[model samples]
Target: MQRRRLGREWCWIVRGGQSGGAATPAPTEKVIGMSFPAADHGWLGAVIKNAEDEAKAEGLKYVITTAADPNKQTNDIEDLISKKVSAIVMLPIESAAMTPVAKKVKEAGIPLIVVDRELESDDFTALVKGDNTGIGTHAGKYLVDKLGGKGKIVEIIGVPSSVTTMRSDGFREAIKDHPDMQVIVSQSGDFQKEKSLNVMQNILQSQPQIDAVYTHDDEMALGVLQAIKEAKRTDIKVVTGAGGHKDVYKLIKDGDPLMQATFTYSPLMVKDAVKLAADIVGGKTPAEKVTMLEATPITKDNIDKFYDPNANY
Candidate 1:
């Protein structure tokens, strides 16, 4: 998942194109670097695809790169700089590991768009993200409300980053008022189905009766369910996950007991980043440099309305 070549395949969509005024043609000489985590998992893969999809729709030139590790990502940044791509949009694997590279990109006068995760400082020209804390709060409150404010829950955490912290903190903050609803333990799921499966297995061994599981991501949520199924644990009544993945939405639609709900945390945020980054690279001024979107809770009550059978994620 290192360096991939560009492929453009859509008519441009610009402000002037759809307006009554003469269409402002898309720039041909500019290139936007679409750098992000590897599409090894569902959400991230959708992120990469949607980012590319936007670029295609806008008729923007792009050099997209994906990395499995932060070190490779750093190297990928240097490569983009050497290629002299006009701007960059990155969703870092971790905040601290990518700060130096982000800072360097900013100092080099390249317009940088930081997406989803965050860094130690504001090292980019713009930022686009979903509300991480709000997602956790939604899930936490759902679990509390479902269990009548009293139950044991296991939290499957995500990769180490500010996103993880915000989600976890928000959940705790939301549910702290309920003293009876206790989170029995929190374990790292690493945002992977396999890793969370193993983690869930280990967690199941120690906990006797868990009423719910709150996974920081839907991928991990899927993992937790697999482990529970394998262990034949009937005590878990609900599982709330973050991220608006299609399969999870289907699970809610199908009336699965454990997969009751998941808050909408879309990967499509990257699409916006790509569009704005292209404009910035072309010397256009955007009205805003920072955009943080909120999360929406998707449950059985509204699953059919939100569930898409053919979405990218």
Candidate 2:
């Protein structure tokens, strides 16, 4: 039986099978309740696609729900519980509201696999994510090296979440050693192209000596690039983005000056989470509770390895 929170709910979670040499029973009771935010961007759409593909591969019945708000997501969790799903795999829309729901899932005894964005506490069965901090650090270091540690850079931040904070923190920490590496304009792009474009445009208007730009997300990078083009700014040499979007990968492969490199953050982490949930249901205890995939710095020299023409992201 699983433990309850607030001394109210009770549920039966996974019970590990025999530890001897006996064969593990293959799980045919494949019902996974996946909940995540609606695809507000193409990158998010890739995440949903990956999750769906993995669930299908395992022959799992999925009650996948997309909620734009926490209230809707909370309701989705209740609906999944009512249906008695074997497990729940969720990428939290936000940390605060989702933490209580994640706690409830734990109390319900349903195996919960948290992916992508994190909840408030480390209460879930598994947490699979990319190294967001490393991403920012790599981008920062790359900019510093390219500019020889003396240049003006602008950063476009993402949404108001742990991701935003960690990425920025990592970049700041890495660039701290170089006193000449100055951040000329810093603003929130909110992880959207239009918003970042507007923000970048405004920054370009105010500043005329930006050497490079670092955007936390590929979508935001697109906006920043557009703003630079519209302004006809030649001073900006390198513009880097995180998130290995197909376009960004292609640009890097072609040695595009503006979209030169990006730290890789794959949406495929969603598939890994779904697969992990199914493995846990099959009496498989994962060796690690928290899995953070390494952030690879993608550059034109090695972009061929990552560039996929047919890939969606």
Candidate 3:
């Protein structure tokens, strides 16, 4: 057995030999590839960090790539294929556009494990992600309770992706019971801080009396906060998702009047996906094709539990 260290974990790889006595040993080198969308935001940065940590612990050679454009991502995958890695872990930029790329990976005979986002085909061997709908629903319920089931709220959404749709749908479902809690204006922020700030500014101008705002991501939340301050609107409360950042935890911990709560959508899911890929190559079968990580709401009462100063995210 040959030993390799991955992050904090140790992995053992068994080598095979010929039937004859004193046969040559199998090679000890093994490599895995990981590809994801560029870290344009805080959550994705966390994902990259966690994946690197896991790769180091498992003692597997790792290759990482990121692309802001779908076409670029497709090309990156092709490059990885040429390298003939043992397996691939991908977080697609666009599910539909990346399906063909997934097929190409499968055709190469490399085990494919997708994280966070999914392609159109089921050809992938495994997937690891959080419940986006659940995160949205939690945010909606929290807003309703804070506003006593009646208030004018606005929503700053992420990019137009399947994950965004699921989060939006769940939020609408949770608030359906509160007829008075209406969403006055909703718009796409493209999941960027500056874009969210500009969109939020326009929304404030159009609707002068918003009681609350729900931005799906913490990066957007920060932009929304700045927009609120610039407008001098103290009436509006905020709820966001992705609780890994230090700023978000601090706001909730101190009971910031504007930022009331956030939902946990850990980037550690990437780490889990990498480990699963290693296991598949090492000959361990997982119990399920899809693994769903829980999404928990982080409120002022329990914010202390997740506040880790040492956390990279």
Candidate with the greatest TM-score versus the true structure = 1
216: Cα error in model 1, Å: 0.7
Tens-digit lDDT string for candidate 2 (1-313)? 1322222322222211211111112354456778878778778889888987787677665656777778877777776776677888988877777899888888888889998788888779999999999998998899889999999989899866778888999999999999999987789987788999999999998996899998999999988989899989999999999888888888888777789988888999998999898898788998899999999998878888898988867
Better of 1 and 3 by lDDT: 1
Evaluated at residue 232, the lDDT of candidate 2 is 90
Query: What is each predicted model's overall lDDT from 0 to 1?
Result: 0.83, 0.82, 0.79
Give a tens-digit lDDT track for model 3, residues 145-167: 88899999898887766678878
Leading candidate by lDDT: 1
lDDT measured at residue 63 in model 3 versus the true structure, 0 to 100: 69
Rank candidates, TM-score, best first.
1, 3, 2
The digit string of per-residue lDDT tens for model 1 on 1-313 reads 2233346432221111122211222445566777788777899989888987888777776666677888878877776766666788889989999999987887788889999999878888888999999988888888888999999989999888989999999999989999999988998988999999999999999999999999999999999999999999999999889888898998899898889989888888988888888778767887897888879999899898888899999
lDDT of 1 at 243: 89
- TM-score, predicted candidate 2 vs. hidden true structure: 0.87
Q: Any idea how many clashes model 3 has? A: 8
Q: For model 1, what is the C-alpha lDDT against the true structure?
A: 0.83
TM-scores for candidates 1 onward, in order: 0.90, 0.87, 0.88
Worst 10 residues of 2 by lDDT: 15-24
Global CA lDDT of candidate 2, please? 0.82
- The segments of candidate 1 whose C-alpha lies over 4 angstroms from its true place after superposition are 1-28
**Residue pairs with backbone atoms closer than 3 Å in model 3 (clashes):** 5-57, 5-59, 6-56, 6-57, 6-58, 6-59, 7-56, 7-57
